[model samples]
Target: MRQNDAVAANAGPRVIVFIVFDGVTLLDVAGAGEVFAEANRFGADYRIKIASVDGRDVTTSIGIPLGVTDIAASIESADTVLVAGSDNLPTRAIDPALVEAVKAVAGRTRRLGSICTGSFILAQAGLLSGRRATTHWRNVRAFARAFPDITVEPDSIFVRDGDVFTSAGISSGIDLALALVEQDHGTDLVRDVARWLVVYLRRAGGQSQFSSLIEADPPPQSALRAVTEAIAANPGADHSVRSLAARASLSTRQLTRLFRSELGTTPAGYVEMVRIDIARSALDAGRTVTDTAHLAGFGSTETLRRAFVEHLGVSPKAYRDRFRTAIGT
Candidate 1:
């Protein structure tokens, strides 16, 4: 807060501008801003400025009032410009005034990036076209559908595509800010910041570790729905394509066809996906690796290892370690 108050008064610090709006996510601004602020204590001077479209203070998502440093159109000497995200960004349309303000500031900033759903603002401004980016996992499908030109990395904590970088929301947003600070300083300086903040210098894995894949409703078709329910009820059961087809009262080929048509996967693939979901649950609940493999219906630990790697990109033991790791060293 002190750094933000004295930013314009300081002459030599690199200007960091954040374009905020009404209903802006507070952590999206604070998490990243704190990284730069902590870096300053180590002699990395980053002058933080919070700007709005019309130069008026706005309310945050949590209903806290945030002060404004300047209007977006007046942003200058910005070493980096970050747009904070909002909860309504995914469901509502981007404000045209905000888009124009971002575009105007981009011309002067050396680096342009966003935290959380702020990528939507960058996308709406036509700046992330043909760029690889990411956002909160819940919005990945909608974002990809809305912008066919942008390559959306659905599970990355953060992604750097040339000069425009985008990152996931909340804690992942903090990770992105740490990476930016690393680029300007070095690993040593970033490690100090991470230590001061009591977080990992670099956290493991991606957003997939935190997202739920089994929350969707079961298939609507009775036969397909029955098979899905059976799979979820007892992943340890013998759910071979033949067994499932028999339960669904369809020929093996027809069952395979239905699974492909309605579920986008073969019966065997569907079973594995469900089993993986079960395995993830078991791991998260502190089950032993061997126990998790059997409970999740993997015939052997090796088989379970293969499935986990193929789908989640992390071994079961490694995934489990995520839960065990503490915040501080």
Candidate 2:
């Protein structure tokens, strides 16, 4: 089957199925569910459902039970199928039957996704071979060790290569869901969904993990943490590599090296992302683009608008209209 254009706006009603396993991470399944459910809030057509390998009641890692009635056959009819991760215990393994089921469904579904340790399941089914994908960071080494052909970027919060998308741990699943929402419904709708969820506005899949920029190894007395706090506190400020290096008592070259090694981004790019994040927060809180631009440290509304379009592929007003609550309760 052919995959539709990746950036197409919301289409009509589609079925999303999450395959749950024993000792599954409940949040992985719920995170995807919430996004599609919230899409309905914008009058976008979609539905969320749960399925299991055997159409039985499945238990979560935390002991909660989910009564999933659909079976693998449901995957053939699904527009999208999500595979959720099991608890991060070493004992977990993808069932042979589930592997076959996923492979079978993979033949029919429009798209496939994995969350956290669920990437392990996709790898097991041979679906991730030669594809760029990611799992939870804690599992990255093991995943890479097991699947040598898959280009596992250990530092990413998620990876979208071809029709298969994989997200990192718990909260990152929410990020992945918001991205899917944006792809289907538009940026504005996803933003509103994020606001309704009381979370930080969505970060693009390309955005690095929040902790990625911190120094992995620092001298005990180094002021790196304080410097990072200051950067976050004043994201709108002109935070140059030299300035941060001075604040941390390290050479500019040393600071840049640290940022590259830990964050997969230069210090400047990280700061720009911080500013964008602040602007998104302001927009989510109902600020207009003009106000958000000023509050988030952009020198002008036009600059902010251009940046939003370039980085997010949407306008500031559209982002706010899609995400912020229209009726103030």
Candidate 3:
């Protein structure tokens, strides 16, 4: 039987604690909340608690308030601690008390995660000094400039550098949470959560930032947008560079230049990355390599395997086995 089948055959409850700071993005908190809350549906006993720096009601970026029952003390007692994103606080200027508190939690927690700008908190607490980390694409330049000592992969949706995990913007928090679910309870449990939430099952934590591939300034005309939509709608289509350019009504050279100028990559490269992203997602959801590649726009399994080897440094089967075997969900 498959690893997912084995995981589903045995599962249990887990504790999750989310920390919310002043002026935090509500969506970041909500995404984490939804994921942990959804764990109960998969036969996992889950208790999610929302907390604050001072155990007070915190105001969100959008001006909403939420009650936080526990302080950073929750982190010490929980199985996982997720730090939610904040709006405009200077990360390095994080409150000294909060910093020490987070550092204390990191020292003892089994799993630690940060969403969006909450990464600043992690960085401030020295949880991500030499660790691979990521945050909102919009904050990449500032984050890099702020913490030159940290290795920041701005393109990743999230980065799991050893024990510390960091994720990009709001919705991507769901992706991070789902990734954690896969890590603990297996992909099947995450898929069940995704289905319940009506979202994509698995967008790999390493997929590119939206602007990493296309348009720093949103494309003026809808033609490029249309082409992008088409590709997503039919990821299995044969989208050669020339053919794709034709669809967008641009000459091949113009298309190439536009992609480089706007998205920082060539058209062929973007297409392949997108295809690989699709394959990664399918694989995470337990699809076989041949099926995933076909669904991801590759012509054959060989093409998929080659790309996986070249870029991800692992065979599809190996990735599935290791990722699954780790959790024993």
Candidate 4:
């Protein structure tokens, strides 16, 4: 057994405490907690707890009430601490008491992490001042402006800097937790836990948080909007600039201008993005590489491979191996 595995084998269950607060996003807490619980169910020794500032009942953003322990008391012996995100973080100021409590607990914990905007709290506590971290994509710019010292990766699902980890919004918290489980036990256990949870065993941190399908938001009546919708609906159709211009009833030059002005990409670029998105979905569904290439409008496996690498930083076969759910391998 590895050193960490041997330690886990001899020691009692490691305590994984989640720090929650008013207006917390329930999924951030629930998702990570479920991952650890599933790991425990798979014979890993982990004890999970929900903790808050006062150990009182707190209302989640969606109005669910959760009972939590007082972090000041409960966190002293924690092996790992995760701060759950809050919807109110961007508007409201960080609580001084909570910051102090997090700082105190983090000082003694073996591992520390945050989920989504919980990174805001970690930043306030000075834990992330010199580390790389990430949060929700919507808040990435503001988070960077607020914490200039920390390197914020807006696209990553999760980032680990030394002993500290931070995940992107919502569901990515589950990914981070599974990664921690893999670190403590092994890949085999993590795979079992992931299969139980029905999630990818690993979505590499580099995978984008935003899919190309939803990246551009054009006006409802804009030609760019119509063209984008058409591309989405029929990814395999000819989406050359001339073809798209004809569909939108504009000259090719006019269509190119509109694409840049409204969607911030050329028509061809947008078409490639849409094709990549379609290819990802097709691959996830266990489609053959050749079939996915044709269906996604790449027309050949080589073309699809290049686009997959350019957009997703992985090859078609590698992407399929990591994310395919249909085969149940």
Candidate 5:
């Protein structure tokens, strides 16, 4: 059977096809595939299949043969088709044959996605142009530079731009897979799947910040940059929604709409994240959490702790101790 587990009572299973090529990163396939397979035990239905550019078996990154059940050209349709990442992908020209296969199956899938650096294949096929996407943090710079038309979210663990989804390097595919399961089945089933997998249902933020609400990019327009730059310059400034709107010569609603459309964040959210960054810097410099709180515009130690835990999944003191500049107390 194509599925790792029986379909059980379902009328039809969600067909999830993983497209692979030689030297494909092994975890990029197994990490996500395991999530979907485990979801099945919790009453979800996912039919997982492995495919290669050709029907022939291909060698994986670990020098083991991964037998393919289908060729990319043969898939009639799929609930989701994810292109798996590889260490080799970002460094070399994507094989034209692989790109062709992705192009052929992409239109037939309900959602087309990529795991880690597999985004290169989709981008190579011109499927990700004008779409917000992510790849392994290590390759994000190259991915962005090579595919200038695509908006590369450098820090995101995963990005879903419309029906297309892209995830950060390696293990983040598990995060994206859980999200897909959540979308299909809901939080209840996905929670069980995550518990079994021994992974968080959601990580706080992306690669750089460990902050859940960081902005994807600096705004492209000078007007928006003016507002953002002001906040960064003085994290302690009174950056309420009304204040930022006035600074930008816009109304609060207009400011919000612009932030959402242009930067993928709210004005207030941006300000808070900037303050968090400032706080992190202060803590890294060996400032006490209380001192860091005011330095970062948080106003109180309790507030700073709450913000840190909520956004970065850690406390100020904990973050400081773990990443302090000095070696000793």
Candidate 6:
């Protein structure tokens, strides 16, 4: 079937099935479900369901119980099938039955998606082979190693390759669901849903999952951590290699080597990433583009715009227009 063809075929509500498993991440299942539920509230016709290998109750990673239907019953005529992520991935063995079921379901569904480590499930089912996909940034190396045939885009928030979609981490599932909603309905409705949920209507799929402040791996108890913390705290400061090296009590060559060894980036690259993260947050908070540029230490709006486009694949104004909540609208 063509992507979204099932939704368009029947004049009735589209059936969205969440394929969950034992030790699933609760947010991966709930976050995407909430977006579709909110879309329904905005007048979109969609019906959601939670399904597992067998029709039974499954415990989430955090010990929450979720009731689910059997995959056999749920996949009968699904418009969209989303495979929810698991906390026990890469290390845990997936049921062969579940993999076979997913392979069968993919042929019948209009579109299929996986959230975070759920991409591993899809890949195991052979659904993601030869497709461009992504998962949690932390798992990218392992995923690539396991599935050499799949093209993994580690930095992307989400990726859409033909009828298959994949999202990074937990919250990114919400972004993918919102994108699906926009595809099935329209931007206005998805925008309203995003407003209600207080999230970006659409964080560009190309946006990096790693924020230098949060995701960068710095050596513990090392000067590199201090330098990174300083950069994050004062993004507006002069973060040239010389300035940062002095603050870290290291020579410029020492700082550069430490950054590359500990953080996998050059000192200048690390500074730019931190600045971009700050600028993105400021834009999401509804700050003016020009003001955000200066505040994030880009020196000028034009410079900031280039950084946004280079890093996020979208202009700053476009990102803000899509994500900034209208305070009283």
Q: Which candidate is the best by TM-score?
A: 1
For residues 1-329, what per-residue lDDT tens digits would candidate 5 score against the true structure?
12222322234888999999899988999999999999999998899989988788889999998888999899987888999999999888889999999999887777889998999999999999999998987777678889999998887889998889999989999999999999888999999999999999997555655433443656476567789888888888899999988998998998899888777688888888888888988887899998999888999999999988777767788788867866556
Residue-wise lDDT of candidate 4 within 204-275, one digit each (tens)?
Answer: 535461444446578888877778889888988888888999989999999999988887689888888888
Any residue pairs clashing in model 3, and if so which?
13-45
Indicate the residue-level lDDT of 113 in model 1: 90
Better of 2 and 4 by lDDT: 4
Q: What are the TM-scores, per candidate, against the unseen true structure?
A: 0.87, 0.61, 0.61, 0.68, 0.66, 0.68
lDDT tens readout by residue for model 6, 1-329: 34555455556889898988779999999999999999989999889988887778889989989988665444777888999888678778888877877777777788899999999999999888899999987788779989999999988888999889999988899999999999888889999999999997856536452443345568688988788888888888888899999989999999999988777689988888888888888988889999999989999999998887887777889878867777853
What's the ranking of the predictions by lDDT, best on top? Answer: 5, 1, 6, 4, 2, 3
lDDT of 2 by residue, 106-179 (tens): 76667788888888888899999989998876667678878899999766777899778998876678887777
As a TM-score, model 4 comes out at 0.68
- Give the 10-residue window scoring lowest on summed lDDT in candidate 1: 1-10
Q: Give me the runs in candidate 1 sitting further than 4 Å from their true place.
A: 1-12, 218-223, 240-268, 324-329
lDDT by residue for model 1 (188-301), tens: 999999999999888767787677655444466557888899999999898998999999899999999887766657788888888888898888788889999999999799
For model 2, the superposed segments whose C-alpha errors exceed 4 Å read 1-11, 88-91, 204-329
Per-residue lDDT tens digits of candidate 3, residues 171-262? 88998888888888788888889899998886543434233332243276745666677777787786777888999899988778777776
Once fitted onto the true fold, the runs of candidate 4 whose alpha carbons sit more than 4 angstroms away are 1-10, 204-305, 313-329
lDDT of each: 0.85, 0.75, 0.75, 0.84, 0.86, 0.84
- lDDT for model 1 comes to 0.85
